[model samples]
Target chain A: MGSKEITYQQIYEENYPKVMRLCMGYTVGNESLAKDLAQETFIKVWQNLEGFRNESGLSTWIYRICVNTCLAEIRRERKKDKNLQIDNLQVSDSVDNATEKEDMLVQLYKCINKLSSTNKAIILLELEGLPQLEISEIMGIKHEAIRTRIHRIKQQLTKCVHNE
Target chain B: MNNFEDLQNKWQNQTTISATEDGFQSLLKSVKFIEQKQRTGNIVLTITIVILVAFLLYVSGYKSATFMLGIGLMICSLVVRIAVELYSLKKLRTINFSKESNTFRSDLTSYYSFRKYTHYVVTPLAVGIYTVGFIILLPLFKATLSNGFYTYIQCSSVVFLMVFSVFLYKQAKSELLKLKQLQLED
Candidate 1:
């Protein structure tokens, strides 16, 4: 019941980059979609900030919103009718004559897209250096499951990137 | 491949743009509009139901079977509107922002599908009932009013509602198609 009321502007300035990066993981490095998802995440955060009970970390709450926004975008697209799926729906991974490292990063994004949504959040947050426990709390899963899944998703991503 | 320092460095160093104040303002405006729409719809429908109840109470005192049946149908239509609104609100409430993306997708997909049902099926059925019930009630009203007045009121209301319903139906259909067209490519 404590009123540690942080303003939405402060939250947006501080967490926008991290949220955008996380959204990119969901979007296969598509920066436009990442930006939109980030915007939507912040919008939801702004709307729900008053209801935040201050029980857990702010990042956990914000990350939860980010994940949900990405999920909603996907869900909405999937539910939409089949005929008009062509409009801005595909995120361009437009790379022109990339080096080996950039190629690997492209492959990394492709593999990330292939992972389950839970595993995607797990590995992306892991990559972002969020502590595993916080990732678990953000995801509402057990700490051990997160630890185990991160190991599995890494193997999965490596094989996927290598096309093995 | 095992070296994630490069990836971590790339992510941490990512230069990003945030939503501007104008963007937030527009977003907040849209959010407020939607909330206001919900509130207004609920209030209007509840007021209608209450009025129907009071009217029904008064009408029941007159002891006319046709009038009672006519008012009963109106009450039914009000209930139908409330039911559809309640169903939609429930779906909106269930939208989970914290579930894993796949589960979240499924939940929201179902929610949209239900919404489509309400738009295409439920609302139309309710309107159909109201239109039929309104037509039926004209005879009852005729028992009291003069021929000229009844004809004038009847023509105006029926024509107005028929035109309005057609407009609404067309709008809803176009909206459904628009939603259908927004499918995302993988």
Candidate 2:
């Protein structure tokens, strides 16, 4: 394959899984919506690829685009479904386990749904094991702020999960 | 038992999902289509404006100075449009897609704010200037509005502009509030 083709394939392979997970978080793990949003994110990344200089890591750039795309989708959906409350959406916290995990995951997603869109983006990226500096660069915030937000997000998540 | 580590552990092992090929393909096609439409629409709009302005100048028989000033304003608008497009391209280049940080959110907020301000504020200001220029040229063409009609049009336009401006301001405020809420949630 040519270099451009190789790069495209690599990007698809490396980022597709994680991007889908991020989309899952934004959609509160709704399978269809997650899939749709993930696809949208990738499409945006592909279209904007020419603008992608090496100022930040390729992954970070992709994540930023994904987050924005997800948020924009959320906003568009909100306009269509005015009665839908972000806070009321159930979050799935299930991991590995089937029966009990489903309930736990649902509760977890509910708390996540309550978070402001940006917070959701931050937590999703952090959960995916992205570094703090990279997150800051993607977010266009100071490194210190990303640190503080991560710390606070953890605290909030703890409180939320406990209440559930 | 409700510790951060426990929650983090569960989240780490969460099920992975993948997007469908159909959706991805469609989105890519849609984006290309939209870009093409916007470019074509802008070109058509520019041509239409040029034709209209030329016709208005011919009818008004305005002094060369006034005609030149109107042309200058149109050129300035075109330049501003190009500059805005370049800035947006630069921003799109700088965006990071993999990392989520507070700064990224803030930068996105700033970028949107700048866009809204230019569209709402600068657009109206340009319209107002053009309106004044139109009024100046109207007299040159012996097409003056009656005194009462002129006053009414001016008052109505002012009121309409004020209402529109207030609406835009409220929308901006709400968007800012949403951004703040997102920040606070973190």
**Candidate with best lDDT:** 1
DockQ of each: 0.22, 0.37
Off by over 4 Å in 1: A1-6, A29-33, A79-102, B2-15, B19-71, B74-78, B87-91, B94-186
Classified by CAPRI criteria, candidate 1 counts as: incorrect
Across A56-98, the per-residue lDDT of candidate 2 in tens digits comes to: 7787788888887886566545433323223423324443445
Q: RMSDs, each prediction?
A: 7.0, 6.2
TM-score against native, each model = 0.63, 0.62
**Candidate 2 docking classification:** acceptable
lDDT for A154 in candidate 1 is 69
Question: In order, what lDDT does every prediction score?
Answer: 0.68, 0.67
Q: What does fnat come to for each candidate?
A: 0.29, 0.47
Model 2 residue runs over 4 Å out of place are A1-6, A30-37, A51-57, A68-97, A116-118, A131-152, B1-16, B60-103, B112-186
